[model samples]
Target: MPAGIRLFLGYAIAILVLIGLSLRFVIDQAISMPVSPLGVVVMALLAYTIFTTTLVLQRKEAARGLAIGLASLTIPGVPLAWFTFAAGPLGIVLAGLTALLAVALLRGLTGQRTREWLSEP
Candidate 1:
């Protein structure tokens, strides 16, 4: 019911789905990857760990925690989203727009902290 729980569940569900898909494509298939299948699984697990950690942090730290969690997930994701262009227009636009939204949301969430961090003495 609460947004934080909903977000945690969303992250958990997404990670599980990613592992399932990776099992189908990476583990089951003979195709090669830039990273090993085990490596891919490990990274996904690592990311999931961060998300779960952030979920706890959110309860304690509020916007700062949510910003960190979302950043860890989406910042790297944005660049990788470009690969979607090869899949066609929908993939390109969807990824592009989602990345934009993520960036804007991150900026909105951390604007003052970011400005302060960047300020010189």
Candidate 2:
């Protein structure tokens, strides 16, 4: 399988498992399956994966962009997973921090000056 497809499948499976676990929590409590905050985080990551795949599939030279984008996604995703699991306002802070970190990592990987320019007033 192509690298992007492999990534997509792995993340997709992970997302499904997370959702099932969230639902199990509700079921155990005998309550309706309200959306868990963790579910939102997982969904966001899954969306990121899908978006990256779309970018790769649309490019003639997918390697350059695909590798950079995937690295960008992973850079903060690892931390975001921890933050989201912790829950509450701390989770929000973690998500924002993770996004900022991801942008920096992406800039480094792509050799793009967007971050430098954005830092200017």
Who wins the TM-score comparison?
1
TM-score of each: 0.46, 0.34
lDDT of 2: 0.52
Candidate 1 TM-score, C-alpha based:
0.46
Tell me each candidate's RMSD, in Å, in order: 7.5, 10.4
Candidate 2 segments whose C-alpha is farther than 4 A from its true place: 1-33, 60-70, 76-121
The local lDDT score (0 to 100) that residue 66 gets in candidate 2 is 50
Clashing pairs in model 1, backbone N/Cα/C closer than 3 A? none
lDDT by candidate, in order shown: 0.55, 0.52
lDDT of 1: 0.55
Per-residue CA lDDT of model 2 for 1-121, tens digit only, reads 3433344445445545765677555455444435656556656665765665454444424434554655555565756665666766776676666666556545553553322222222
User: Taking the candidates one at a time, how many backbone clashes does each contain?
Assistant: 0, 0
